[model samples]
Target: MACLSLDLCVGVLLLIGLRCQSCAGSKVYSSPGASVALPCGTRVHGPCSKISWKYKEKFFFFRDLVESGKVIDMKMGRLRVGADCSLHISDVSFMDGGQYMCYDGATSANTTLQLLNNGADEVFAVVGESVTLLCSDSTSPGVGESLRWSWQKKELITANQGGDVTVSANGKKTEFKINPDSSLAIKAVTAAHSGYYECSLFNDSGLISIRRRILLHTLHETTDLPSAPQQDVNFTLTCSLTCAAACDEDINLTWSHSSGEQQQGGAVVKINNTLISQLLVPKSQASQTSTCVVLREGAEIANHKWPVQGGKEVMYSTCSVCYPRFLTS
Candidate 1:
């Protein structure tokens, strides 16, 4: 332990009887009002029975969280250590943003928790798929507080002072539920659910508005399949969505083949409100699966799988006037 430093290391050494080693910086990200588990003890060689943890923030004092496998100061009952020696925290608020250290008798592991800004303003959903719109805030609603979630000025759900939330029927998309963390979950999403969603709070300080404006784009997919691809036979898959002109910046649709090599890719076509992505799949590797995937922000949000099974050998389409297709890009 560094004796000169007045950090949580000193607090743990004085309060608990364990020595902490050098800090290993690891960054973990989570949204506000969400639960997170921080990993620890990757360098330790022995058993992880006597684990202890400490916390510190940039502008705040260090805090001792766990000692001898027990929580010490989380009076709100939100901190616990999992069986894997990782610290779990629920309903995390912005005030809880800090660095956490997990230590054994000799060595230690450190992790820094970064609270996301809840950039969940716009959430895209697939047609017939369930979509969840998060209502994240810097602080969890306190007791005697109430929250009202609205869509385009229409009431969807409300949680009274007692924390019992009541979801009301709003429009055609009726199925909805508020998760324990105050996020609203809607089932079987459609184009009708595309609009602004707002989460409002009613407290002693009057109506405190925590507004979340969201735009949901529902992707519609269709594929021509169940016909196994032979050597030269070809089929195309299409995925389309309707949105504003600028909405395609973060969304992508593509078809993937089982083998590393691709046979052909069709040109993406946009007609007014609809954007379509089609792929010409060739029978390269039979007994494998091909997929049509949708990506947003470089992350796959939806996919449709088509298993390619070769039935029998077939010859390529050959005509004296026909020419081989080529990629332009």
Candidate 2:
């Protein structure tokens, strides 16, 4: 996402019948899927009509939420005007986080809504394959602070302020290792190792750690036929996706063959908070590699390639295979 000079406007939101004097500026931090009320930052006194709200999204895109004391259409009723003329936002998302400006016709107030959540990351690996749950830092490390990593709320490792690190001996210790950069590296991950991993750093401001959650999933492939497809037999490679948590956006899965043939599934249904997509590729010709591409909002997020013939599978994340290590069977 590019952050340039703000000249963009989606539409106008108009709110009416609210009076304010002078609201103050504020900063609010919320997680994904929460409700928050952004004060117009105005102090009340006499008649201060014609209040409006504007927001600058994370990508520098500007949105007009209110215009002249009336609420416009945005988020489909998720945004509402409080009795006090504050902007009440429900079902907050990572995409909804940004800077906001409120104007009460005379005085204007500014606010910043910061969303505290993990990057939308999900790793797909075969069972028994070694994988690394990367903890990328966007903030510079401060002195006299520790970086801690946990899985399902259990603290498994810690990197002290002096940079010395230690892994716990809590039975699962042997299965995990802490890398020099503090990223959690698992020796060999089975199906049981699949879950959410959290890395956090605390400062006076709060959890400055940008990456708080990482999804790890072990894939178990099933074949329609008992044995592999031969020259005459047709092989259908099933490409699937399983959401480890609540999917924040619409995820679309597509199967791309080395032959340049691409097929995308329609209407990715969410069942039990998990999403699954499948495709069948017939091994008619000399099949080399079949790639599974995951897209959110029409952009590719992850690309996993496997041999339609026979070899190890590879998964590539954002910025050219962010998964730095590959394991052998």
Candidate 3:
């Protein structure tokens, strides 16, 4: 039993030694101005051994910094190595993004030093116009793996230019056709369509990176409608607010007839953000009503009245008169 216990202890030590030998510490820096550090460490089995650091394929520093405390060459001048073999480089540049190596004579380790540019390409398109979203890395397009484009309505995914969609991401060249040109071609442009759209790229290493965002805006024309019903012939009154996109919610439409009759309906039945209110009076109940009120969003925006029979053909007009004192009171 004692021999078995001794063997178990040896096995545990071996496992720990393997992990320590393979462990590599890594740190990242940003491009256009940042710095990073790479730690070189061992299990401390014996006395501390020599340490070395390398950037890309060139050696930047050695154990000399621990004893001499002096800068080396141009790139190495910016680096500092501690007694424990940790490397530090200040004022990092775009070219500094790449592979880094750290060595402790007992065991050597390598780490990736990625200097993210983080500057995304700007993509813009006018409403009803076609636009292409591009993704780029330090390397040019058609040189890497594949690029992807995706659109979302708030948190929900609306369109995908890759996978099921017909987006092609060959090498670094990724392209997607916006059939109708606009994201909201089939659906009208509404406030809901105004959100963040992301374009990304996937490399051979299976890393997904975002490229840019596409901003969408829709322009629309505005009009005023009546707020109160006119005391005219019993006719249906309709009010509509049209835009490039569908409304997020049903429009609230209210109808007010001078005869103390109030009717309400939603815009859902109109297939658009439009309201229709009918105040029917059989030919027997026909009366000389003067006006009809159309209330939208709880505000009397417009009013319409039956045309006074003056000539052979009736002419309609919009009256800008104020609401009666009795109604306000």
Best by TM-score: 2
**Candidate 2, residues 1-329: lDDT per residue as tens digits?**
24234333221221222232333466666668656677666653333247778886544355778776667856678887765676778777888787787776555667888897544456655554677777765553456434567775677744554433344433543467666676777766555565677776644323433345667654433334327436566555555555455555666667666677776533455555445556555545334666666677877666656554432234322232344222222
Candidate 1 on 5-99: residue-level lDDT in tens?
A: 55744655634535445565566666676566776645675444688888874433466789877789774999887766778788878887777
Q: On residues 71-155, what C-alpha lDDT tens digit does candidate 3 reach at each position?
A: 3444546677544455666676766666654545556455556665543222212222233333333443335544444554222
Which pairs, if any, clash in model 1?
Answer: none
| The candidate that achieves the highest lDDT relative to the unseen native structure | 1
Assess each prediction's global lDDT (C-alpha) against the native: 0.59, 0.58, 0.39
Q: What is the lDDT of residue 273 in candidate 2?
A: 40
List TM-scores for all candidates, in order: 0.44, 0.47, 0.27
Q: lDDT of candidate 1 vs native?
A: 0.59
lDDT of 1 at 35: 62
Q: After best superposition, candidate 1 residue 237: deviation in angstroms?
A: 1.4
Q: By TM-score, is 2 or 3 better? A: 2
